[model samples]
Target: MNLTLAIAIIAVAAGVIAAAMRRVPIGQVHSLYRRGQPLRLLEPGTHWVVPGLDRIGHRIDLGGQVLRFEQPQADSHELRGTVYWQVLEPERAEATIDEAPQLIRCGALAALGESPLAAGDRRDLGSRMKQALNGALRERGLMITRVELEIA
Candidate 1:
């Protein structure tokens, strides 16, 4: 009888552990899904989730981050450096569901496509990339803070 009782208690404990548990770390946000549909955004905190019902989707960083990319050119030239960006609205980032690095790279490449790079001061031209990136990213609740590039 005692062994059976101990097994019962252990089962209950496991169930409780699986049910009442969720956490979002600082400088990040997570998207919650219920019944396989997007529910809401979970900010940094301890949260409670319904086991087997509510699920966590993407964990997006809210803090500033930089992504280093190597952009290859036709003349064997490659511009390789990092781009800085920050999430203005964590909740809105859920809609895009794309990671920060991908977003930064996409925006930077798109910007470079629009304006062809020419022979000039690379520093001056690289710093101006932020202007082009913001045009694509601002609507997605992200903004390009700065662009640091090394043109090779």
Candidate 2:
């Protein structure tokens, strides 16, 4: 009876674990990071992750992505642009999502804020900001295909 009870408990635990883990499918990517280290990219299919330790930071489809930003100066001049991008390394994005872009934004804003262009330096500011974003994206293996500038 004791042996049978032990076997039943083990079976129950296995069942619970099986229920907790899942698979990721293809054509889509899931980012996984644990303890500041990035794991392999989870392709489309079933992906089993640790119940509470590993987390998905972001999911990117195989397709491209777009992001836009605009900054208005006190003098009514503004800088605006759009970025076309795609992921190259899933692991890097998963591990550094929270920090890389934050640092990049601070750097870009500081550069623009200190510039002495009388007309608010919209063109120059936009160029610098795009460069900063490209550098930040490189670390995560994302390619910035284009930066289109426009007045707003």
Candidate 3:
């Protein structure tokens, strides 16, 4: 009976230790939070975290992401294209990481809407939209690498 109890205790301890170990894959970052407050950003590696107290709030991917957006204009033409983006600073983007796609989509639509539809230059429009988006997103740790837009 005594031997069985000792083995059980050791097994339980091992399980607890395993549970506290967290492995964040490469090309990704994790935002750690404690007691509902932001703590720190965890890079790609194996980390030891307090199982219950420390929780991963966000799993931010560092790889480039594509956001496709389509907006119907008042004249029946649709502005559509793909936006290439990536997170440059995980710390700064932690707060709004989940909404990054939506933010980019909305910003693109707004820029397209404000531009003259009769311009007939998709390349120029794409470059302009890229600049406008980069201006707005840089502060949030995000960047627009390229914008491919077409009015159809």
Candidate 4:
């Protein structure tokens, strides 16, 4: 009975040790939460975390990304566009917003022109959308590099 108990304890210890070891890959980062609260962002490479005490909250991509979305304009026209963005601050990105892509989508929807934009109007709309998205997301740590919008 003593031998069985010792073996069980050893197995549990090994499991804890394994759970504590984590390796965050390159180009990606993760936020560690301690006791269900936000802690800190872990950069790429090996990391040690307390098992069952600390947990990874969300894995965030640190690289530049393009998101395509289609939304309706105020005039009932379909507006399609792609947003190019990169994370300027990881901690702010994690804490400031729940989802970045959705925020961009919402911004695009709000900025859509009231009329179906023409070829010449598309350029103007892109600039307008860029400014609008930046206005909404700048405080949230996401920098919008470019916005391309057209009447779909």
Error of 3 at 37 (Å): 0.9
Model 2 global lDDT (CA atoms, 0 to 1) = 0.65
Please give, for residues 10-121, the per-residue lDDT of candidate 3 as tens digits: 9999999998999999999999999999999999999999988999999999999999988887787787899999999998999989999999988888888754476467
Task: Give the runs in model 2 whose Cα sits over 4 Å from its true position.
Answer: 1-21, 33-39, 49-62, 100-104, 107-132
Candidate 3 lDDT at 60 equals 97
- Residue-wise C-alpha lDDT for candidate 4, range 6-25, written one tens digit per residue: 99999999998899998999
- Candidate lDDT (C-alpha), each: 0.78, 0.65, 0.91, 0.85
Candidate 4: give the clashing pairs.
Answer: none
lDDT by residue (98-126, candidate 1, tens digit) is 76567678767765653445667566766
Predicted structure 2, TM vs. truth: 0.57
User: Each model's TM-score?
Assistant: 0.81, 0.57, 0.93, 0.84
Q: Is candidate 1 or candidate 4 better by lDDT?
A: 4
Q: Where is model 4 more than 4 Å wrong at Cα?
A: 1-10, 72-77
Candidate 1 deviant stretches above 4 angstroms:
74-76, 114-120
Best of the candidates, TM-score: 3
Candidate 3: residue 113 Cα off by (Å): 0.7
Ranking by lDDT: 3, 4, 1, 2
Task: Mark the 10 consecutive residues where model 1 has the least summed lDDT.
Answer: 110-119
Give the higher-TM-score candidate: 2 or 3.
3
Model 3 TM-score, all chains together: 0.93
> How many backbone collisions does model 1 have?
0
